[model samples]
Target: MRHLALISGADANHTLDALFVNAPLRDYGLRPRTNDYTLPVLGMAYIATYAQRAGFNVGVLDAEALGLGIEETAQIVNGMAPRWAAMNLLAPTYEMSARIADKLNPQIALMVGGHHAKAMPDRILADPRMRHLKALVLGEGELRVAALLEDMQRRRELPGVLWRDPLIGSRAGGVADPQTSGQMLGPDIDTLPYVNRAFLPQDPYRAAPTPADRRLAASRGSDWLTAGAAHGHLEANIVGSRGCPYNCTFCGAAFSANPDVKIRVRSPRNIIGELDSLHDQYGVTAFRFVDDLFLGAKRVIDDQMAAFTQHRIGERYVWDATGRINVLDRCTDQELGTLVANGLREVALGIESGSDRILTAMDKRIDAEMTERVARRLVAHGIGVKGYFILGFPGESQEDLDATVRHIRNLWAIADQHPGDIRASVFEFRPYPGTPVWQTLIKNGYNPDELLAYGDVDLTQDGADESMRQRDEFNFSVGIQFGGVPLDVVRGTLALLTREQHERNHSGQEAAA
Candidate 1:
């Protein structure tokens, strides 16, 4: 029997409906299917690898990618009969995680984690459905969990385990803080192991287990992983760093939300070594950095670029990363040219808003002009640009909305002129727990549960609507009237942008989910 099993279940969010609590949600298998396919659960991979290396038997089940329902997932865990089973929950996936916890074999100690879990630890432990959870991991799990398991097996004093004895009167939740936690931004990330791809289904994200499932993605235009399946383009997601340095208030990765997460960057040597390993072992040629701050700032990005150049990594491979508009705007043409020559195929930017006022409010140091300038410059350099925008933020004004609409159109125009691609991914602003906006709402008399009660919203109701056929896939809002902007206006703007993106994809350009 394995010592542990980590699972990523379907996004069966049941947090909506009831005013103050979650109601029994739909059957997991009955959840509406999407054309989208997910990447590997890297957190689970890291935790599994760390625990396994520490001499504990560990395994993983990515029910999210494998498209397994709660029942099937639990059955597999029960069959594996591991001593413990754990899951990482996002706001969207919290309900499914809880249901799976309930259905697990009583003997298997359950652990719940991820940012969502950290934001709701007491509630999770108190919830009847989650009574099976033995612990709730707070922040980064690889180091904390491994040591916790070792101490538990040896019956030693728990180094990071803050709470125990669920039956006790106090029922305090466990917190995994050690010397490293105190550093907050000082951990040597190179020490962490390369995430073992074997833990996940690889070729095409191991997403399509059967032929019919493959048909599903094809009907919606092949998923992003399918691009990797092209000759010599088999891709993998890599993270050169952990944690964001920026203060985008609406984002959960904002520093304020991650007080315990130490910001760590992998040395270029360490990163290249993993690239070589993936290339040799899994035949992966293309890479996408999933880090929140891959090209965060100038000095950091320069070091990363210098490493890629020294190794001539671009000669054979192409890669993409997240970037900041302010930093990239300040970049010299020569510096950016060097990046382009090094197979820097694309850069995903956090162009959060178009209005200068709104951008400041979001803590996105860059303004509308900077975003446009950077987008144009990148496109001219033959690098694809993916701009992410959030609308309907709390207290957002009509001028902000109009400015965003105009800004998206400007970027779309720039995209049309260059060989490089530019895609705008617009999302309605929903209150994510632990974000600055969430705290602000609470300060203004919003209930914590009310802020957490947004469920999966389906915005694509009309099948005949040719604009943005993929809008429903990316829509994560509950239509909460947090802002004065009318819901119709927000959606109307969404439709406009979605239709533009739809047309772009229809014309053979890549689309984002």
Candidate 2:
């Protein structure tokens, strides 16, 4: 059997869009187009690996990375002439996926998976508009994919498949009975082959410019930017673990669509083996670990570090990862220093809010004090820190906004001492479907239809806040804001923060001269 894996690109209607692959912020549609970075979907890559191992001809297509529109992507898939096609689906690209399915030959068995399908398989399967859809694989899809393909070959009932029941008639406008064979989660990830990156585009994918990079270039002029542009570096993305242990209300990964949410990690030896292959074959020296929470248990961290040291991983590559502040806060200075020594150049912290009260509401578990302690520790250890903050929640108030501003200022001050070491961005909260926050909003009289309709455009518009109607008129490359606080006040606060950072950078430069 021949199978194809597909990723949809931005539709013509969307101004700017980027898929993060991970659950929350699965799709980021930002304005001004600061940078172009498309990461390979490791899950899809893993699925392709399993398929090939099962003796099926497999091909991978990342429409976003290739910059191909729906028609172009369809042409490529049609040319491949595969019997089966599976797509990674997100809510923002739901309409685009449906359109692409319509364009493809109806005879081709079409299957969908990912955050959206996993969260609402019934809604996706029942929609008559998606009649061309055949099946959906829920949760972790590697084993399910292999099983589904084998079942298709033998004309057996599909296992781990979501489909419309043949028994159910057009009772409610042809909404068929949603039935699932079963849910499947893969065994040891180490047992799987390394992601087949060779199937991906050959060109080096440029990561989106960070806030620190933007501010540094603005302060230092084009000479610095020119110098930075000349560096020849290749970055690859890998996942060390699957699923998150902590539950944050706004996070789709933690609370949405994932029913059998088990956290599985690849052995350090397994991870190092992949790195060795990349370095030997592709000369890739930079990596981004896309695990939801990379720094989980102390023993896991110890084993990974030991493997890195034993295998000389630090000598070959520099890497960054996503982490929780509480985990970082618990590490000793020596532990962090060891990580820095082993090529841990940067770590991104989801310090979602500065207000402790708001943090509690979001079930972040950690308070503002924990955030400050962790930021200071990471900065002191000479590790680059990237901060992600959110502006609006269901009950966020002016006091919460003020606390967030103060926290940002504090983080900026720490960065001031070490210019170019800290990057921060504050995004307006968008209530993604399948999350606790979204469900709560629905229970509180928020219209679900309007929210889903907003989709990718929701980033640029505020569905819950009427005051934010005119906020999108301004062009602030830094971040988005959605709250009762006046737009001017928010912009003024941002400007003051930027001005302070600029002055600090100037001072540091003069001293260096």
Candidate 3:
């Protein structure tokens, strides 16, 4: 009998309604069909690789990719009849697992792991919905989970795994003394085995297994998707680095808690080598640098760019990445141009707020002037810049809100001043657990009990609309605000701001005439 089954029930993240949140489900087209395919999450693939390497019989059930509902996934798992079943836990999928656990109780030792499990162990343990879960793997789970399966096979205890006990509160069950593993970035990422994509149905919408599924079910070959034919040029998603140094308030807690571990990178040669294979085998040209801050370290970023320049893949491909505004500001004009020349076509710059006070409150270390300067410079270099802004920070006043509107207006003006240069995005603040702002909000009596309530507030609660309507000069507008800023207000603000920018452009044209 297969001792363990690394069952990843296909996930459907309907709760968040944001595509990136359910990451693997991103490839689904707007019209939701039963047969759309989603990219396999790299993390889950790594976990499956490590588990298989540890010598246990493992099978996968990717319900999300199959577009199977919870009941359908449970039926499949019941059919597989593995001794232990493992599921990944993200904030949005917590309820999904609860529903699955309710249906498949007492048959399998269900285990859950991921960011939500690591950050909120106490809460996860206490939730009655997940009480039936045999164990919850906390912290960096890939290596830890592999160790856990080995111990489970030997009838030894599992370390770092929380189990329910009637006599005492949830106690550590399984093996003792699990080896210490840092959340630091892993080494030689390219060496990890390719993900086993066979378990998921080829046509995710059809709810029918493919020939690949039969091959994976029978365990005929260890490398199921190695031929790279299944995933087109667009299916590849690679991470070259781990960690971010900056402490953006709204950023996820996993990143903020371990800031020093930020910017750890694999060798440029190794990264480039993988890129070449991905390009050759999978026909992948469009790549995304999935790091928190891709250009955090000057030396590493420069080295990677140098490699890109030497190899010159820019002729065929385009790429995008995320970075801090300060990083771009510090970059020389020549370096910025070099980056664009080497295929850095798009950047998501975290200019969290246009107001200096709010920026200081978040410890962002960037000002409006610096943001404008760097954004303009990126545009001049023929690189697209997307400015990220935040609203509804604590200690913000009406004046600060006005400043934000004005700041976005100035950016729109920049775009008009130099057409086809830059674009801007506005977002509201969502205080994640364990951030400095979260703690402050807690201390100041602001309740954050609702995980999905950040974007649901009524923005007019603070008379923000009156302030925005009173603005004398405007350009491009971004209408994201916390406290439930009305969607229409946001639209109107953006329209007003755009109209002002257009008037400015017309004035310039008339002067030329």
Candidate 4:
């Protein structure tokens, strides 16, 4: 059929990057209700649309939204009879993703991309069962993937691609020289097609965020589902920018990790235009901007907010975007107001830690003071704040843990007083190789194989544990303690922080003793 299948493989349902339903979790009486099932195409929509426009046939298989397990998903793709299947891969879900690849019809050639794939291409290709994985696309994959689809019918040299041929030997370009986004070769953000939703299931796009997200949002006057229902519309995830300028050690967005990465933003007109198309064509009124750096700087914030205001985006539709704690810390109350006035219902911050030591270790360049100032200022203006934290970092101390807990409590206190709500999205740290922290662990006699072992370990957890082992950390580290703190303290603190977030976000839960 000369068809290309763009697949978003299964991810741990517990974290923000989850694309698939957690059947294993739900089977054990865990919660993954209707709201959690459907999610917009992460980056596959762009690749699909771009390939389609380039005269290639592309099909989307969202395993998570379909609620199909590993075997069923493989069965369906085999029936589709695709010549090439390209997937976005992550470290934690490597096993699940690899399983899907293994079960695919051997006739279907595979290509992989995403940060994990970019960092660990050799490991993926070395798997004996992944023989079908012929190539790995690095960095922003829209153009690279389109080129791959065009070239896959017959092998030819292309920039930014690493492929292995059944006939020819393995090729270079995986690690050495893949260009990141916003380079001279990168596609213009404004001109790309609106991600062809026609390629994906429409119903999934119609659903709102998970229940916890909705509750926290409502606490801050940012309930997208209710607000969207008022206008007889639905919700979808959108992107305003690509790549990040920051070099936070825990993040792969650093330019050192990817070759020549640059942050790229769509023009205000282009962004507003997409909103209009989504509204009129797809019935989507509420949006969640999933940019790594949506609010780039004051100038960018002004330009986007000004354009959105001109288009009446605030009045007609609502949205939430990623924010920089350091950037917003410097923003004036009026500047924050400008963002709120332009339909920014809430801002998600990579607060990372409440302790300056941990924050400095992260290379986040923002401190607790900056975070508190930004959170307080934003909430005062009625904009929601979603603070994300990492537990058991590589070198965290007891004092650092105490500071983080205190900071989270302070954020909650701020939310309690204002119309804005705060959500502390905490995750146990897992050091992925190639990230700065991974190198630190390596210097400290840590083996990357240890993390790979976690990924390779049995994902099933005992019922005694409230949380599943197959979490986002499964790809990083399930529980090898890197920090000085003991494993018990780490888990206990994880439970404590997450439970508090649960009480605030879910509501109706009695306080824990």
Candidate 5:
């Protein structure tokens, strides 16, 4: 039987391989951690399970988690000697993937896929650097991969597969036409196999620790402490739904490469079955629903919650998920209360900015007041709330920064009333390709080619010669300033506001103790 090996490039050290299906891109405030938490490659696990069912031997390797450098990862792949090998690709990790591919035996059938490949297949293939990539799989890979492997055995070209053009010189060829093959979206997500966690390493994957000021964690006292201590110990990542419906300007998922932009979900029965399997087989009682919008559809949320109650799933496990403030705002108090009753412990809100002007510019639709209302409501229902804030956009000024600071103060006030009910983080806006904002940046003199050539590193850094630490400081310093706001003033204001919030939360924690 032909064996297929699936792998991720070695850790880049500046970023975490969390959010993407096949590649590592920063999403949902998940940056390269100072800690040891690594999210599992859910997409790969699904593909592995599907391949095994199709009579192919499969093996999975996470180079980063194992702390293997690119050369070392390639050596291990060479030892595996699989008939075919595929590696996930991220924009920043593209160079590392290419390096690893070069080190592999040339005869090994090598394929590449993931967010970067799907978004820029033509650019990826046309690059002289990626000449070693045999084929590119776009969008969701499970069904397409099964087809590709079958075609390989039969020695025929397959639809949905982008093969390098043999006639063109590698260095001279222009970008290939993306229409070379018809890429199809996968079948009903509900019919897909549950991720084969057994293929993963036996050691438990760690999660970033919950902040001490996190609302639900603070309110529950001992229970929260226990869960925090066990953060990533028995945690498993699950996706109840696929695709996102909203079109936030900075989101790649919202503008995913998938041809069909519709949202698809697993039935409540399917979700419960997987949860049960995780519980019984793996002793996992903690879950992180990694969906782009777990609560995007109210009916889906209601059905899933009802199923959890029916199966007593919530009684046994505690879970957290990502949601939009607008979506949660629409939920009635009763609905949210029921969710809290059913094990929803914490939620990460993509409250991108606290400034109404910035929020409007980003096309976020929701305003500052609405965000506060929803956040407080969630806390009231006993669900922990983490607010994600982004500073810096095309045109923002001191007033806008001040507005955000005011919002943070409001968040601190909420936390004071309900201690540990709030956790907030700020990130500089990154001009990721495939987003509307990226195009705006390009028009305003930012060069896409130059950025791409720099390969994938942390997005919040300068492309020139500067350490990541230096770049981070620069980003935070200038992230919120424009015409009226002096850079130092903006930085100082943000520093003061953050310090005040920190002191208040510390006081609250001390008092509670």
Candidate 6:
């Protein structure tokens, strides 16, 4: 039997040309070059695993890692000519997927899976360009695709897949029930196969100053801008766990469902072992734990630390992670210090908004008070804390926005009370497709039509946002509010902040003199 190949595309950068250099889209400084590449295709990875387990020949195409454009990717696939080619689609990248699907040879079966298919399956099935595609796997696609592939091999009927029928207009088949909805059946982190890095493309995509240059380097429909700091020593993004316990309004809709478990962590030994191997083999020394909340549990943190110490690997690496404010508040200073001493160079706490009202409305589960306490505690430990805040919410008013700004100021004041321990970063809220607020906005008639209209565009632009050039520095970044504040005013505010900081440093220099 011929092997089947599953090609998954992660969300790419949105086009910022219209927002920045072009006149059409609004120029919001809040936009960041960050795209969704680091997120492991946990779903697709499992599908590959399951299909392999089921005795079908299987392969995975991770386009970002491979640095292949749609045409290049299609050529690679066409050469291999797997009987089936599947691509995962996020709500934002449906159009991209559709275009990529068009590139495949007619002989290859085109399939898609992800949140957009679940929420609005009909919309995807109805696209005339994509209508002739082989299938759209519903729910968690690993099992669905695995079973569908098995059936296909045997020429068995498939019920969970969507297909066009002349009489019914469009119909779906081979669906397992609620129990199997969107579930990926796979092994614990240790049981999984090592990622076949050999399949990754030889040339990695590099971001450029111009869109045309990036396109020439990569290919059409590829626009993810990679970001890094000076040393060329960027951290290796890692995941100790897949699922998060919290269901924030801004988190993807798929996350809101009862998570498979509170958490499913790789053993501390497994984690440290991987980190060590990454260093020794891949020359990767720095790491960023991109879990929804790393150090989610105090006990887990302690356990992992013990493993690291036992392995004598702590000093070999530096790391950063995100955790809740409450977790830090509950930690003793010693525990915080220990992590820092071991390797934690910096930590970010998502204190989304300062107002208790906004926090509750957004289901953040913590308030301004807890946020302050956490910042202060991290400061006391001499650990750097990056404070994360968001500006807009579903019902947020002008007063709410002002309160959030002041709260951030107060948070900054706490850092000032203990310099170098804490810093502030703010993001304007964006109603992304898979999140609660996206649905909430629709529920409240907030007119997110344009956002949804651009939902399938990649978030990563080939070039950095033009606003990045407007100021020497900026605090309000990533997911900025779509409206309410003028872009010029936001730019001016950032400029003022930059000037004031420069002045303060000058005065401090004089005092030292």
| Per-residue lDDT value at 346 in model 1 | 79
lDDT of each: 0.68, 0.62, 0.55, 0.66, 0.63, 0.54
lDDT score for residue 155 of model 3: 21
Q: List the residue pairs that clash in candidate 2.
A: none
Tens-place lDDT per residue, model 1, 1-513, is: 221223321111321000001111223476744544555667677777767677666656766555567786677777665666677877766777777777877877776667787776667767778766666667776766665565544212233232345557355533325654543223467887787666665432322122212222243344432443332366788888988887788888999898767677788899999988988887666688988767877888788889989998866566789898888998999988888766677799988778899888888888888888889898887788888888898888898898888998899899778766788888888887888878888899987776666565555652326564445445666557777799777877777777777777666523222
Cα error of candidate 4 at position 216, Å: 15
List candidate 1 segments past 4 Å from native: 1-28, 151-164, 173-187, 202-232, 462-473, 509-513
Q: TM-score, each model?
A: 0.85, 0.77, 0.70, 0.82, 0.78, 0.68
lDDT string for model 5 (407-501, tens) is 87797678657523777755555555676665666677766665455322333222222223322322322132323656445444444544554
Cα lDDT tens digits, model 4, 1-513, are 221233432221221111121211111112232323444565777777776787665667766555456776666667665667677776665666777778877777777777787788777767766777777776666766666666663224445567664565555553323444334236778888887766556432544343333433354465544554333337667888876777788877775676556567888888888888888886677788878767756777878877887777766676778888877887888877777666677788999899999998999888898888888888888888888889889889999988999999999998888767788877778766568777777788877777655432222222213233223222135568878888667666766676567556546223210
Best by TM-score: 1
- Candidate 6 per-residue lDDT, tens place, 180-277, comes to 34333323556554433322222122211221122122322222111122123334566677667777877663366434333567888778876876
lDDT of 3 by residue, 1-513 (tens): 121133442222211100011222211222222323454555665666566666555555655554456665565566555566677775445556656656664656667777667656677677776666666776445565666566554323444567666568655555554243233123335455544443332311222222222222233232322222123224345666766666766566445654434346767777777667766765655566766646656777788898888887555555667777777788998898788666665677777667887888778888999999987887666566666666555566667767888887787677656523345555444555556666666677765455423222233343444433322112111223444345454445444544444455456446433
- Pick by lDDT: 1 or 4, better one: 1
On lDDT, the stronger of 1 and 2 is 1
Q: What is the C-alpha RMSD of each candidate to the true structure, in Å?
A: 7.6, 8.2, 11.5, 6.6, 7.2, 10.7
Which of 3 and 5 is ahead in lDDT? 5
Candidate 4 has a TM-score of 0.82
